[model samples]
Target: MDKPDQIPPLSIDEISILFFNRQNPVYIDVYDQQTYRYFIYPIINRTVFFGCLIITLLRPLSHLERITIEQGSSTLALELAKQHTLTEVYYQKTHEYFTELLEYRESELILTKGKELGLNMNSIMFVTLFKISSYQDLQVLEAIIHRLVSIIKQQMARTEKIVYGFHNKVTLLISLSSSDSDHISSITKLLDSIIKEWNRKDGPPLNAGIGNSYYGVENIRKSYDEAGKALSYLTEQNRPGMIRYGEIGLNRFFLNQKSEEIERFLNEIFSPLWSHKAKKNELEKTLLVYTDSNRSAIQAAEKLHIHINTLYQRLKKIEEALNLSFNNTEDMLKIELACHLKRTFNA
Candidate 1:
């Protein structure tokens, strides 16, 4: 046997009251459709019970009061619906503008539309891309995206930043005042903080790629392309971290080379190894280890977890297959360049 639940007493003073007047008189009752019960409001000489507590009022609503309340509620709902429609239209237009900007279509029109929307494109200093690792569920992905966007907006304290979500990536366009000299350092710190906070929240790790700062709206597309290029490097290496387009040094030049030219160079340099499928991968790994180890037989062997004799044997086999001498400075340079090209372009 259990004691009955205690019901909280009604307190009229705690609740605010709205007064309304109307001409017509009629009987009216308010019922909660979801709860399948009559709405509760305590009046003088009348007690009303709600779910767990009681709310009190001074007097019962007259028919005139009910008519006034119904009209007021309808008006408020209509106003809210209009506001929602307007918001939806604005967001649709914004998405279209951003899509065109990203696709490099109608730069002039995009800038014009951005200006109309009160977006200062000239203030944009950086484009950053965040690539999410694979996720199975769309709802989970959406949740992560919403959480990230909310956190970024709160931390940055700037509503001017533009964030757009694609398949599994988010692109952010960061804007800074013209007088801000420490833009790069500030942006880097902000991004680092965001990544750390996100990881702390038990979110999936993201690979961030940042593009160089370019002035003017016309160059925005270029910055986006550079950010994409930086992200490509991260994906190719299968590494989870941040990479800046400007920081990649000489590899930038090689990356910009025509695909056909890179393919030709790779074929010419490594065709011999490719001909022998059985040992190609093994030889390629050995060659990379040897070159990366500064051509030190002992260092390369240690890195590869192989004996010095075995490393020597592999090197001799590679020289024989390519009909080239590893000792020759020119030959070593070409091989080194080819290896770099392959790594950077995944050729």
Candidate 2:
């Protein structure tokens, strides 16, 4: 057998058989410096051997060149397959760790894994969820997410951040240095930049929800839950903006209530307005404007683009419809509460 670097002489019949009968063979030219001759050889199954005795007896040089290029492409494809397999395995293992961290299970083991993965669990950490507006091709979305993650990781290297894509959303667990006081502001700026980049690239619109930052790996689950809750609110409200868990305040209390419960409360409070088919929304808006204007008839009318006397007339109708006098502070309080509920729940 000839070595890979050696090319032996052959007859035209042998070259014809090699080209037609061999499977996936590479053709190359070998130069003999001593004899100053160029030889054509076929590399088949890891063995090098000569082709046609006269180069012209073989197929056109163009055909041979095409085969050589195809061989190079095949080799490149094989290498890429190997790399993709390795990446899938790595992602599986990392996903397991992520699941455990989010569940708050085996804190010590997760912390150890974090250490092995070069994550700093001692820093102040928060969770953020970036939600895309609609479904897209998984591969395309993943490519976009990978690019965004690479950019964020590169920019936030000093902050110790980890990003993952799961359930059609990109989740980021970022840590801040001890001296970082404006954590929410910093993350908001980062998200704004990311969203701008995504928009520039014609990607789906993205909304981000951030959780409160806490110290230590054990508290990561709390942040994750908070982030998820914040994301749910953003989705339910159909609003595209960043919301922090801590900033929701009293709205969180109302959001936690069941839809049925909220509906029942609204029905009970606004039954009189509900009875009016043509003017329910109009009356509700009037009440809301009045309440927002601190019950000042002039200001409420001005805001609503109505006359002061018209505002008083509407207020009187509201009082008669609810069968309660606004002079009674308790009744006024109930109306104010109803207005708040309406504004918050979009009822």
Candidate 3:
């Protein structure tokens, strides 16, 4: 059995912990009107899941003196276990109807005893859900998500929520705490797992947003907004399945300008090449040579490893395509600006 992940920074010698290794635990808890199932699968360490099976089991066990499960599903009752004199909840399970009953008999305690069992208040948590395309995949992902969150909630001791919306597409947003701006271990791990899974599934493009840290309820909405913007700009950045708010901040430098898109601007400025059907690098070379030579064909020709007559012929083609004289300073400015934009995109 896999032991509960250790949450660090203090002595835990006397603390009682339950183990559930072999596989991710999926508990079926039947509540008054719902069957709550807590699905657990740990990747880097984030447990994600939801269902009726979990609610059913948690109700009875959590009423015991104290039970500590790796995942958060039973926390509601277990949190109050010891304080309420019902702290004897115990054991984790894979599945089935009466697991909670066995746990109750084994624990011999109730909710009151389990109050101190969890490291709840100190936990920093971020949660968000995505609406996905297929309901079929939902069941599959449930246990995996549960296991992932359980690890983070136990080890990192920070709570996180990643939801898959119940819409046409699978949209996900996860929030995590990082003391340093440079490192976000939990969030990065989630992204890696999610991306890998997306690749394996190979469905329509996966659009995702990752929210940065925020302190209060109000700030959380901002983080979500940032995540959404980051997601929308995925096309500009291309390769999907992951995008960070910070990445969106870097996109402003790429927006189109007054008269043309970046691609079209490259065309107008490289217009000379279109007439001769010359390629991108060739057009760039010609401009650099002309600019460096101070409009001297002889010097430019030598720089290009071409005869002066050949250089003259290329320049004539450019002039004809642009319908402007090579000697015109205004035309030179347009070429220079276009080249600048082109280089900016390349770099």
RMSD of each: 13.7, 14.3, 17.5
Model 2: ten consecutive residues of lowest lDDT: 48-57
In order of appearance, the predictions have TM-scores of: 0.55, 0.68, 0.39
**Model 1: per-residue lDDT, tens digit, 1-347?**
02112222323212212101122223323233321112232221111111111222235657886666656545654564465446446545655666676675556777777766546777756788888876766644654555465567678775457765555777788766663557667777788778766655445777888888777666677888899888877776676678888877767766556678888988877777764447357788888889888899999999999999999999998999888898899988889988877766676
lDDT of 1: 0.65
Off by over 4 Å in 3: 1-158, 169-178, 201-203, 253-262, 273-275, 279-281, 285-347
What are the lDDT scores of the predictions, listed in order? 0.65, 0.68, 0.44
Best by TM-score: 2
Best by lDDT: 2
Residue 258's lDDT in candidate 3? 32
Of 1 and 2, the candidate ranking higher by TM-score: 2
C-alpha-based local distance difference test score of model 3: 0.44
**How do the residues 216-311 of candidate 3 rate in per-residue lDDT, one tens digit apiece?**
333444555566565555544455566666665535345433334777767766755643454554645776677667778888888899988878
Minimum summed lDDT over a 10-residue window in model 3 is located at 10-19
lDDT of 2 by residue, 184-293 (tens): 58766877776666655545667788888899778888988899888887777776667788877766777677777877877777777654456466677788899999
Off by over 4 Å in 2: 1-88, 103-109, 199-201, 260-264, 267-271, 274-281, 325-334
**Candidate 3 TM-score versus the reference:** 0.39
